[model samples]
Target: MSIKIKDFWKAGVVCICVLMLSSCDKWVNDTELPDNTIDESQLNSIAMLGRIEKGAYIPGPVIAGVWRAGATSAADLLVASGAISDEIVPTAVPNSPFYKELDEDKLTPDNTSLFSVWSNIQNYRARAEDAILNAGSLAPADEDGVKVKQAALVNARLHAGYAWMLLADYFSVTNTSHSIYADHKELSHQEAYGKAKAYWEQAIPTASDAEKRLLHSLLAKMGIHTGNYSLAVQYINQSFGASENFSFLNTVGTVSNGFFNALNVNSRDAAVDPTLVVALKTTADKARNPVVKAAKGHWSLTLLKERDPLVVSDYEEMQLIRAELIIRGLLTGNATDLVNSVVVKYDATGLSNFPAGPALTLNDIVSIRRIFLSWRGTRLIDLRRFNIDGDLIPGFTQRKWQWIGVPEIETQK
Candidate 1:
């Protein structure tokens, strides 16, 4: 893989100054290191370690300036995933064949959009590893410094874990082979998830209370992805409380939220599926699926502002996971109440409940998730979980690609 040294410097310099305080003066003033190279030894202090961890979460040079670390990447993933699934339809305005190819289920290794997602995520994982290594090398002189070092290590592990989880979720095994390439080796989906699980487990010893919740939520997601309902419930029990409203967002600093910019500001690269639009006409549905008219005639999601943080995980997702487990008979609880809890929280009049009966099927849960979790970027995983075929809109057929293939750049290596 090739490294964009210029891109690294551009993002790194801004991130170092923005994320660190006066503690960065020594590192910034050092002129011995070449402008193009960042010496690992200089990243010795706890402050520098934190800076490196934060850098992993900011937008890197991918798709020019549009693609970012957390939410932006999540947004693009939603577009591709929604296009492939039933939640979104491609538009010609952006004139990017990538969206259209995804809509038609003709994913190729050369899809730049997928490459952007792959590269940015790999960058996040790599930088996170760098932070971990730097943390290990640091010898804190004070208790506060030790805490900072520990926090940086935990945060880095969380970022690295999520990177692997995303790789496992979004990319598929090609030619009945590897799903992704890392460290010059190919990793299958299960192998990737295993790596994610290990990282999260390692962080458990030093993670704070808030970080622990995030870890459990992530572990629950991994269980869901792997069809381990028992394991999902195990972690879900240890995750955020129902009313906590916990969320983990990837901070982009000065980078624009690429998903919002694409849909509303830059161009209408993708539009809301007509099926969802019609469903949103209902009062309760409208509340859950909040959207506004874009510059073009299509509807754009208003759930996130242009600079709003991209959600990594939240309590709503935890509730949905718990509800699914209840429906699956793996856990004991009123799945209806759990589902309605989300509906009531988002809907204005609280009339969106599913008629309070046993009639709720897995499909009902999936539909509710599709609307409530629309642009949050869970649709693709949901589609894979449900083995869904055909678009939500009537008469639209889904194509064969369940997971995006490895980008061409990686394959050539």
Candidate 2:
């Protein structure tokens, strides 16, 4: 919401053709608007539009359900039946309007309606990219202008990365239909994943320090897709080191801000918009909605529901990534000892310390991430990636789009 930039980067740039270039007069020998009059003071309307669009990007992550999901238990209607498929559950899904991350396995390309929300996500990403290109180029003597442009650029690029990440996660194999994406013909599984990775990497340099931290977090997500836990840890760690402002409430917008309205629908929202995951504890703390509330996955009913309590802290992600790397033998030090050190900082359970017994399992390290980064939308990516690769990660079931979840269910009416 708030933007900051260093001093030299402050000025906003603008340029206009001056009429006086044709004349050599001394007094009035300056720029002129049109034929006789030039409005040098007017702000560029295109830039103003770009500015507005840039600021609107803050909501991309939370609305799309990029945070953790407890199998769509939060929504009364979706999870009540207990099937928990993409059709009925995860209503706040990334590509779904009524669910979080629709089942893409059962999908078909010829049908237009089923593909709507997925298309919308892609649109959101395109819009953010466009806004960044338009306004991010502005430069002028105004110190505030520079900050605004830089912030806009970062916002657009970050959101772009977020959107692409969602698409990469959903299509275990990228969609090849001409109607699906920018190229019309979908890419190979590796190609789609690579595109997502490249976008996030490209964004690192232009993003602000705070944004760069977030970008690093997203980049680690890409690494996870490639099964590169070491690289994932590297990016996640950098995010923790650089970000001074990190919290669920602030890192993402629309946590409880009427984003749930879309849950009333039956189709996936869009592909390019990063997804969101929201929780409800119920008055009785029954855990009726999301179903799984284990130590790490659980939500506290006593705490406020409007903002994310499991708000992302770079430290939490760093610890988990480090633990994973250590478990994978990427980091040489004791994983058990390392896991112990990280978990304490994570929950601050006040236990004496983490046990220095034996090396840990993938689930053990993931549990640390699960407990610490709950509801922040990071889990979906994890589930979609490694789980798809045939790893036996817990609570992940692969569901692709089938006609039942989309227009087949809707267009019939």
Candidate 3:
């Protein structure tokens, strides 16, 4: 009986096929609906716009179950930059060839880890652009929708500006040619910075009050980086109040904090530089420089947690920028008082102000930034800016590289 039932089902399928063949023209004439597709028009919803905005910050699975570059690129930058500079040192560990490459300053264009960071930075910019476009295309029907659309556009622009700024800061330019994207078009470092400045300037009009202040701080930082001191001063005046202690952080979500995972949590691919540890031990700014010994007995920082936000810009950084300008004769102020103010706020209670003595040299500002801005992804730039090389600290080796080389993939035609 079971066999008979199977035969009956097979016969029924054959009959249906024969009937469809007999009416093939009619069947073919009937319209076929779209299968498993979503049109661009469908993405105009507020929820979709919010998601596009979030994508600007979060890493997407670019490599299909193999790697998530965008999520960890910033962390990679921190580790590589710190190891090359004086902030940290690489440890002997499994699956850490990239760390060794950066630590030894033997980077090649083929370095996949560094390439991932490069690609992800570009990805962030692309995603931000997408958010801006999508937000502009959307028409808000209510106040809530308007807020969401504006937030998406403003955040997108801010993040895009920062992405461009990072590219200009960390990557090298050769004879005014720096390949930035898959398209193989080359841009000089200054051109890259100019792009960042444009995005920031565009964002100011629609930004919320707090966001405006943040944008001003970012513009000031860009100005300082590009040697536009007058512009830096103008934005610094609008960025933060002296007592604000304001900081703009890239909030972590779904992705873990890169520095914590690399240096302290998952693997000890790097540890706080021994020189920094010794420096911290004698200094009263322990509050600002928290440290703990790793499993290998090397020091690691506790400045970040698994999901804590990464510092983007801050009041202290602005103050330091001003202090640098003062030392360079571009600004008028007591650089020591500016530096001392930060020291007093962060220094352990009852520690005297940054020794009131000789005028603060650029090197002194570098030293202060080395301590206060530890693990903030600025050390390498500082080293480059000050032309610091030939043994950063006692027993440390001479510096080998100034900026990370452009990834090989970008240079390919």
**Which candidate should be chosen as best, given lDDT against the real structure?**
1
Give the candidate number with the greatest TM-score.
1
TM-score of 2: 0.55
Model 3, 127-216: lDDT tens digits are 555556767887888766676777667776776677677777777733135434423456777778888889888989988677788899
Off by over 4 Å in 1: 2-40, 51-68, 173-175, 242-254, 293-296, 390-398
Question: How close is every model to the real structure, measured as TM-score?
Answer: 0.84, 0.55, 0.78
lDDT of each: 0.66, 0.41, 0.64
Give the Cα error of residue 206 in candidate 1, in Å.
1.6
CA displacement after TM-score superposition, residue 124 of candidate 2 (Å): 2.0
What RMSD value applies to candidate 3? Answer: 12.6
Using TM-score as the yardstick, the better of models 2 and 3 is 3
Write candidate 2's Cα lDDT for 306-352 as tens digits.
34332333554555666677677776566666555544543355353
Segments in model 3 whose C-alpha atoms lie over 4 Å from true places: 1-41, 50-72, 141-143, 173-179, 242-254, 348-352, 390-400
Of models 1 and 2, which has the larger lDDT?
1
Tens-digit per-residue lDDT, 347-375, candidate 1:
65767677775656788888888777776
| Pairs that clash in candidate 1 | 71-310, 109-408
Cα error, candidate 1, residue 240 (Å): 1.4
